[model samples]
Target: MTKSIEAMWKEGFVNEACLTAPKINDLYNRKSQNIVDKFKDMFDINIKAVIAGSLIMLIMMSFIGAPFLGIYIFCLLIPLIIIAKMELKKSVNLSKGQSSYDYLMNFNCWLESSIETYSGYYKVFYPLFFLGMAVQGIVSQAGGKLISLLVEVLPTDIIILGQPYYLVVAVVIVTLIFARSAEAIYRWDLNIVYGRQFKKLAELIADMEELRK
Candidate 1:
């Protein structure tokens, strides 16, 4: 005549009086721990993917004859991995010895904090990334030949820092636009990569909150 945990959970949900305080607390802990464990696994996978992507980018850039740009991007990527690892470390220790509700709350706060931190970095990073690409394009062999063709056909008088003034202005404008849209771009990226995980986390938090009421 012992009830299964699932039956107890259902019974508790239907009529709270059927479950003791310890049983309810244990169920909450189990549910939250399952969600948190899944999140941790996904986070680890995401970090690994980023590290792999950075290596691929470096190799591709080097093969494409943009060693300086490759190095620059590699350096930029290092900090991203570092920051993610740091956040992961913090998350690992975040909810130790805390109740299920408190643990979920801490996780929610950590997610918000992590997103804000990454968004700030991406805001600066996106503009710089575009600018670097622009510089590499203009200084490449093809760019030199194209410049020569333009010089033959168009007026060579419109120069700024030995480059075409219009080209410089265009690069600057494009970079500015990217900077302005960086947050939206980051959100889009996040949605593409981890939208389901985030949705599940939000739902788990909401359920926990409702259970506490």
Candidate 2:
């Protein structure tokens, strides 16, 4: 009855391979968690840097007679930071007991949504930022003198209603061109900042998927 006993043992006994499934899943969980933790760390640093830079710019602008530029940029960025911080909190609070793959997928979706949201904001902010700089330049001490000099040299045909229509047209055109490419520019900037972390996350997800198969 040895063959019968062997068959019964095979049917009833658990093996090392069976036990390994949970360990493998746990490993994936840890790896996925690490990837997300790294992203959060990077994001936190960026936020702090933005805050410090804004304060520095405000102080420098106050000294240089362009405090409005500093205030304008701060106002534009503060609301964005507030919204992002709230979203970050929500991501961190995702329900427990999710599969590693599902968690990563959720995070990926969140990242894409965040990028799109920021891109929408950039569409308006980028144009206003450029336009504001143009205005700042025109009103600066050196810029005011330079414009006066140019006004004396320019033809009256280009000056309409006592305003330099050509300069206005040039500024608007440049701002429009920059605005048109703002999303691409922001994506490029994001890639530069987070490319390595994003690549690791994708690779980890692929590995987990392959293991499942």
Best by TM-score: 2
Give candidate 1 misplaced runs (Cα > 4 Å): 1-27, 149-156
List, residue by residue over 85-179, the lDDT tens digit for candidate 2.
86677678765467667788888888788778878888877888898888899878888788788878985567643458888888889999889
- Model 1's TM-score against the true structure: 0.83
Clashing pairs for model 2 are: none
Q: What is the C-alpha RMSD of each candidate to the true structure, in Å?
A: 4.3, 5.9
- For candidate 1, lDDT tens digit of each residue in 1-213? 897766555556445455544577677778778878887888899899889988998999889889899888888878888888988888898855866778878888988898898899899889998988888878999988887787777766789977877778888999999999999999999899778878877887787666554
